[model samples]
Target chain A: MTAMRPDLERTASALFAGAPDWTAIAESGLPRLLVPEAAGGFGGDWGDAEAVLRLAGAAALAQPLAEAMLAARLLADAGVALPAGRVTIAIAQGRVTDGRFTGSAPAVPWGGASDAVLAAVGGELLLLPPGVATPGLSPAGEPRDRLDWQGAAVLAAGRASTSLGKSGVGDSAASEPDLLALAGWARAAQVAGALGAALDLAVDHVNTRVQFGKPLARQQAVQQQLAVLASEVAAAGMASAAAAAALDAGGDCRLALAAAKLRANLAIGRGVAIAHQVHGAIGFTRDYPLQLLTRRLMGWRSEFGSEGAWADRLGALAVARGSAGLWATITG
Target chain B: MVAVFALPPFAFPDDSAALRGDIRAFLARHQPASEPAARANCWAVADPEFSRALGAAGFIGMTWPEAYGGRARSAMARYIILEELLAAGAPVGAHWIADRQTGPLLLRYGSEAQRRRWLPGMAAGEVFACIGLSEPGAGSDLAGVRSRAERVAGGWRLNGQKLWTSGAHHAQVMLALLRSEAGSERQAGLSQFLIPLDTPGITIRPVIDLVGNHDFNEVFFDDVIVPEDALVGVEGDGWRQVTAELAIERSGPERYLSSHALLAALIDSAPQDPAVVRVIGELVAELWTLRQMSMATAAKLAGGEDPVVEAAIVKDLGNSFEQRLPQAIQAVLAADLDGATPLLRCLARLLLVSPSFSLRGGTREVLRGIIARGMGLR
Candidate 1:
């Protein structure tokens, strides 16, 4: 199908936008979207997840929607019973000693607020209840805390034989990179949404806000800047969505994630500069709605890794393929 | 408020892979002998024999109706063939304009007789065509065209000049825009005529480009006469016709793939240096994203909708990507002007000619203006 189900997308958008609560989200089955429909989940693929995350980002929702969806996936892989209320994931190896978990997971999204955290230590997967956290604020003022679990009660624990991370690495070991890729992909999807929303704001402002006897859009310079910004937004959104499609198809997931995140990250400053430039003084104000999207764009751009980190990873991959294989790697 | 722009993932046809394989096989055998440098801007370089071979293999006018020597294929299938040709740097200049825009325009706007006259020969790749939109003072400002065509006995008498008519010397027909309605001006009272290049009182002279290429020409029409049926679509509808035609003109594989040869050359020449690798990686990421956007646009076209905004977006961004590619490479990698390496030569030639990338088809400013208008900007 060339189009997404607009009815389902509208429902997801309604559920995720503007401070949707955990009970509402859980009831809507938004988090369980990745799980199979036969298994009582929404039975959506990664592309669907990409669409929801974009809506969440466009609304600049403070909840850990991405993490909750990811947690459902990890728990499904581990054959753990679905949890009630909010869930989150930490792509770190927590220490497991005699059936209890210890150690801290950094930058866990809404970690203190989640009902449970899906984590792994060594080769074993573990689902632990929410832990006490020293919260750190994201650029958007959202909670991304250093969530500390000191022998926290393990709700469930087991080995996921074939998991998301295992495909990147040969063994069934918990590979941090692939897990991080999943995280990066979610952020990339969110960035795409945020950029589009931001561009809309900039376009509206340019059309309405006037100076020198005409709307700002009447100026050639303004049009050029907005055009470039629009292009960046389009590129970022497409890259992220395509990556989700590639990941769903089980084809070159790592490269897709890397490219998606790198492009999304690179698009941020270029877009922010134009959007803020076009909006003038009001865009820079604290009370303005434009800051919400721009700040989240900044947050998402840095979350998985910096642009340099992704560029380095992607570059090393191209080098391994060599000159001749590079084209095949990209096109194939 | 109108919904924000969104580009969903393109659902390619089920046979995309098989089609791609077939094109690859065809290209490997039918490819002409040319310098490695020729592939970078292969779409502009003519190879009549190669075009004939492609036609014989049933690649030209691929999506046209079977009655016109076409296979009656899907537009997606044609997109695959186009991208494959571009990726491999195949020279497609001989019939590119005809196949890409002129044929499609005629199929939409031409009389049945006109279609019967040109469609078969074009499908066979034996007939070539060029666009005659820009005039002496009408580059991006096409509305400023001063060319005039007067109604006459059994025909229309045309007298005008068109500049930057690419492939005019090699083409059999010229789709020229002229001022048709007397005393009318500015995007009104204009008409398009499918004039034969060999018509009486017509002159085609070469206009060499910065790269020393003679693909461009100045076409002069001094009282040239054509049958009344030569007017495509309706009189005084050239403005609307050409605007619609630009969607086809700007939204093709050529926008981004013109310099693909240089990208391949860079990859072949690059080392394991981190700086170079980082550059290449960013390039790859951007290219991949652009491919997605372009494919989405193609899908829109294939679905029988002329996506004005999407097509402009493709060209606006695609043009920037191609035009900046060579300079980006040369900044990271040193190249001597006298260097004989493929990468070095591609870089030099591309740098010299890349300025035209954004200028041709539609200028970046023009594309952006169209996009801005589509966005509801003032």
Candidate 2:
């Protein structure tokens, strides 16, 4: 089955293409889309979330759509009530002493705008009310607010609290969702969408913008560059889609997520370069709209985990399997 | 915005696990212990006995109809076996083209009598075939074929030279693509013929590659005559017929799995270096991703959609992975080339042979162009 529902896809395209508002996204019931039907929410899977996150990325949306949906699912898994306002989950490590969080979630997406940040500190998954969020920003200038809830009272804790798969909160019926990898997966989907947007811009640029008496696309040199760019875009899309399916199937979560994130992170370099290069100085302008995609592509590569970080994780897994098990590991 | 290379959700058949186990068992029992480097370029390693044994076991032609001596299995079923054989580095060179494209082409386009005559032998692995698409004059610009076939009395006379005809020395027949109508050009009036290799005035000369291997050859036809039934499909439909199976041709496990043996060897070497581990890990990640792309392409093809662009994406990406793998390994670990170990030898073998990964099926540039055209860049 396709991950994207037709109606949701059409709405997302229109909504993101224009000004994407959190109210519209939450009002459209996107944050609750992954919650089980028994729990007062849509019983959709990660595949659906994958498509939404991709659209959010394509538009380089400033709204915390990925974070909000993930927080809802994390709450659902913990058997907690869905929050009314926008929310995000802290994927970074923090410590809770005397029912107070002392560590800061350095890069909580839109923490100031979110109603609360669901966090797991020292074996307890707690929802911390927003308290004096220190504003930070991603390379795209989107909100990457720092949440430091010093001596803050816990809003709630889940029925079943366990360490989140990444560094911190959630479990599923089949497989536990690694919050860190989940965040990375969200960015990977975003990277894929951003790459697609960049490729489209580059393709359109080459076909229309005349250079040296012909469209840039007419030159073999330019065509070759675009070909490379297209290959990267296709690869990122494949990797993202594959990981989404793997998570849906309850397959190897860590391996699939690592590969997907790495693939997308690696692709951003060539993809962003070719997209901007074809437009020359015109693309470099603030009004060009190409930077909207290229900037996210540049920042998203290091968002969840940089290429090198994921590569290290994969390498350790590979070495643990050893050479004899390499084939089985790959095929399995 | 477009799903140009969008891979659909796919799962292997429920019985594929058992099917894979059986093939693994068969391979373990029958696979001869050949050279370590041989398995790296295993698909080009011709072993007729191994091929015949595999055929007898029903691995060959598993997807064709039972009436044509096939096992009547699904395409995904056959894909499982094909991948198993490739991953294990079995000598599959002999029946690869015949089982993969030529036999399928004949089944779809050849006459009933032609199918009855040729398919059973091919399914049995007793018959081997090579493609005659590329000639001296037609490499990447495949439409510039100079091969000519004339309608001589009672039959057609073929006169042309086919280049890069892999396994021509062992093939029983050549699925030759030639211009049937006089003075036709650029993919027009082209026709395919099932010309027997032993026909009169035919010569097969080996073309040793840089690695000094005899896997490839040049086949010359001097007025070779074949009966009327030899023509596959209607005249002037050869281009369409050939292009029809390209997605399937480029969508197999052979594209990326070729370099698998080398990765296995590296793991076996047991280098504890983190850099080495990282390289191997990166390769595995890339391989895993490529396989997903391939499976998606396969699913699309099985669903009866012609995923030519998707298949090209797989091939170009897969080939680059294959070509980069050896170099990636070499870059991370300093292999003692002079007193080389097994891993180093496999690296060398792959470094020499992996160049053909892109060259085979279609060049990387050509595949990318197909992807570009599919994206409306052309």
Candidate 3:
């Protein structure tokens, strides 16, 4: 797992080297990473998508890989056909009660851009048409699109009381292993990737943009920030990679994913800030790729439940288990 | 009054509760000593018996291959065991360093001979190791160490004094960081040696801590010769090797577990004390934050990345909380001390022990420097 992961990481890095348009790469790469051979995917696990996210983060590629991966899996599970080229998913809440599935998810990711929208409403995977309108205010920006469907079909359902139930779309309320692991894996990997990219961007900026007659990298303050950033990137990378490997191996991937996402979210946010701070005034401008990367990092951190969200989850696990149990669960 | 409150709910799979139950049952079967369980948080109990029991339960060396006596479980599973052990206050102090830190380091960097000889025993908790890093002249400034190991016939003779050698008196071996051959100033020509504690010409004396516990030691080596094989990694690569080792050392729940017992004591004893409540609430929040960072590092370790900086940050923050716990508790109790209150007693113990918080693994100053270096500020 360790040896293979590093090689996959390098592959991701090479794929995103100095690319002008990231949307293309994300559109293509995200699905390819998640697609299983049987379902037209790359036979990938949640871990692979995580690897892709980590790579994208390192390269500072700004696009929605998370949305794509989730949408693809939702479609695959629901037995819905996915668009060959570009697809995104929006997951909102709807009806689910006592082992039965029903309801609708409004204004999903790639609502306009995606050909089909996949959601789990009332314990069922529902492929709804992207409504042609927007939901109210989104924590993220304006809706990517609106979904309008006549009658979406239920492609598949693992179990009625299963975690991927209708209401469990955004996060599996029941801790469904498959979806839960995948979400955690993807977020952690993306955070690792973002940290990696932030480090690179910061390094490049520091090396090229001379300040005080020396590159920013030479400054003690800049160096300290970079040092910490590098550590965070390394840590996040390890966490995301570990989570992915666990998922691939079909072990308990939750705690790993939770830890990875929690740490990566915090690191990515701090990393983006530090990178921009080192870059100074010029980094704030939209023309610089730093801004784009920073925005993505920001968006990703808030996505899949924020830092506080993940932290609280881990803390609850620790506190409730009262140390011994927590330790056993974590180490098990 | 300190406001003590539970952390906000984190939405996870509901089955986490069931999983928690399974872990609890496993721990109960292995080590029934659940009370005074505070010691379990250290997860440093290197007792051969308990470790062997853990091995019997198939819990030790949890991410290692089966050939090495490991269960090869998921990182998460191992994390569960560590958390449980700490909470239970298991006397893992004996094998804590080896299992949590050195075992992994050896697996990653040890020679094949080193792995074959050490890994299995370590997995079974048969051989315990302590880190020998700090010196009287070198506390936070690891690069300033003057300890020397000179070449000799079929071996190397060591001459140096190492202080703050935790578990040194009890451990079978010590991974000592020293100068292999003298070089230009800081961090040059350094090396790490796996020194057998029972080697001739070596003497170890306990350095009783403020609490009068034999937790650390002072060791002197007078022409103590070790086989050439004792050298770990390459000579003069000690700086890099030690840096990696420190990253592992400082990056786990143990870094923050010291204060936890005191915190629990404080909260349980005075859950309604406004001051206690407030302090506990704030500390809990910070603890939550630190866990996020720490867990991420754990995940990274599982993923095979050495997150030196992230680990440093965790240590820095974790140790800070650990150091502050006593004060937080004292202010909460606000009791006039004949120093007799249960809170005061706990506070006193924590105060005495808290100084060791920054001292262990790496001092706060040293860690901060690493953090600064990581942040590109230094």
Candidate 4:
């Protein structure tokens, strides 16, 4: 299967090129890429949508494109009518009693700005209207609002459909497409993209920045550090791509996504350090775009699941599989 | 913007599974049952008998020409065999150097007569070789090699000392790099010689490593005489040839599999503690990722691409993972240790040998330097 869509890629880059142009993205039909054509949306699969997510990540696009795509897929899967504007998903833990949902989801991506919020609660999908979330900002200054739905009115609620189970058409095996595995892979893809941006910024900075009568890139110390950073980036990219491919193939991808997120987290820990080290004081400034990508990397790594959480999950799975079956599990 | 390094997702051929199964079955038959500590040696153990068995099984010289007593298999086939041998902690060191590097180097640059004379024996695992690159003064800075080879009546006279040469005492042949001309550029004037360890005036003395093993040696070539055919490739091409060989040497399953025995032991005996599980899980994930990258590099080599940068990346990361594996396990075992378990023994042995992980092949610093240049930074 093709791993890229040039048309969607171009639209994503052009629309989210600078500040997040949410209206432009919506008008360009990019948000409908993951929604089924039967729902008056583009008839694209997850593989096609990954191109948009990856490009949005590489450019450090400040929009909630991944969340919007996930929300559309979830709504479409739940057989709910498409919303008018942007949508985001929150895998919240709450109970639905008497047609009211009461829960608090901290740090929901684009929760305040989105036209609708699709919260997953106990195997059911609840579509909540905007303005229910108290707006907040992540450390990276993105719209990571604290969504509180204490007896909040639900626009639509239903069992999130498993018709797409194991088909690779939707994101996860759970009734909702916004489970940890799906979110982990999505964030891993973004982290991979941000790493690319970091590498680019550092490489360009070192090549152009001069010191001691030569370019800083000529220094062995700087060169070695940059190399280490690049290797981490390469590794994170490979892991993320492998996870995406596994998800697209409808394979058992929990382990792949865990590994990808673990690797991505490790890469961010090393990659951001080296990027700033190579760029020196200038990289730490707010004006530099390097901070934009690096900050997002730090934020995305903790979302869906932290490295520790995934590591625990993966480790438990491995132990359950035992040593004799470990190699086969990994290689198979 | 510069394109990121793309390790395009790829899979091994469908038949790789059968090859893996065959190797597994072969290991079940001939694999040695060593204690946990000795098994930690993994690829460092030199067992000529085991090497011969591997050769007889068509595991060695797999990708070489059939005329050279090779099976003419694919690179992935060779990768499968090597990884399996390494993962099982088998003793394949006797022919590891020749099978991995010297054989390929000869096939690429050796003359027809040279190939006809040495390739068959090497493919048969009867011939063993050790690299002679480092000296007392020049370990990573190879261009500073002080060894000299002067033209004599029927051949050349070699004079120099090679230090920290692994498997040299057990090797039948030594690939020595020497300066054949004076007052040339740093990388110029260097030549490679296929010196027999038994040649006159060559003294092979053991240099024990930190692990109390005699695998390393110091070879003193005091006016040793070698025939004209002992010269590998062409004169003044040693630097280029050695660099090409290193691309293969640095990228392999062996680089990361040194501590795998310990990891397997840990997995087999690990408790269900959440903390321990996290560490083990992280290790497994990293190992899987490294294998994917290494296999991709192998595929590239099979396709005849140099992949120097990619190989260096693998070695650097693999070495880091291997060196830190023991300590990571140690952290997990802090609260859960009972002492004298197989896991403890494996960890103890790994701690001793892990220091050499970053030293052998190439130092982490040197490998990073190569990677930087590959990134167009230098």
DockQ of each: 0.55, 0.59, 0.06, 0.64
Instruction: Sort the predicted structures by lDDT, highest score first.
Output: 1, 4, 2, 3
Candidate 2 chain A lowest-lDDT run of ten: A160-169
Which candidate achieves the best TM-score against the true structure? 2
How should the candidates be ordered by DockQ, best one leading? Answer: 4, 2, 1, 3
lDDT of 2 at B372: 75
lDDT tens string, model 4, B1-378? 444356566577667999999988999998755566666757788989888887888888989989988999998888888888888888888898899888888898888888888878888878999999999988989898988899899999999899999999889998888988876666999998888899889999999987688999999999899998888898999899998888888889988888988888877775777788899988987987898788878888888888888888889999999998998988877644444677787888788789999999889999998888877888
Residue B133's C-alpha lDDT in candidate 3?
A: 86
**Best of the two (3, 4) by TM-score:** 4
Candidate 1: fnat, from 0 to 1? 0.58
lDDT of 1: 0.81
Model 4 Cα lDDT, one tens digit per residue, A91-188: 78777778777887888898887788877665667898764678888768898998877787788886554533554433344443335566777787
Q: Candidate 2's residue-wise lDDT over A1-332, tens digit each?
A: 34447777788878888775787877778778777789987777778778878888878787888877877887877767877787787754566668776667777778888888876453456788885788988878888887776678877775322433321223444233256677788889998888888888888888998868988878877777777888788888888887887777664567888889988877887688888787899999999888888777777787767877788877777767775465565555
Which regions of candidate 3 are displaced past 4 Å?
A: A1-33, A58-63, A83-86, A96-107, A135-185, A208-215, A251-257, A311-325, B1-88, B94-133, B142-355, B364-378
Q: Write the per-residue lDDT of candidate 2 for residues B188-257, one digit (tens) a residue.
A: 9899899999889899999999989998899888988888888999998888887885657997889888
Note the residue pairs that clash in candidate 4. none
* Candidate with maximal DockQ: 4
For candidate 4, the C-alpha RMSD (Å) to the true structure equals 3.1
lDDT for each residue of candidate 3 in A193-297, tens digit (9 for 90 to 100) = 666666667777787888789876677666666655665565566566655554554444455666667767656755677777888898888787666567666
Candidate 4 chain A minimal-lDDT segment of 10 residues: A169-178
Off by over 4 Å in 1: A1-7, A21-24, A83-85, A93-105, A119-134, A147-161, A165-176, A322-332, B1-4, B32-35, B334-337
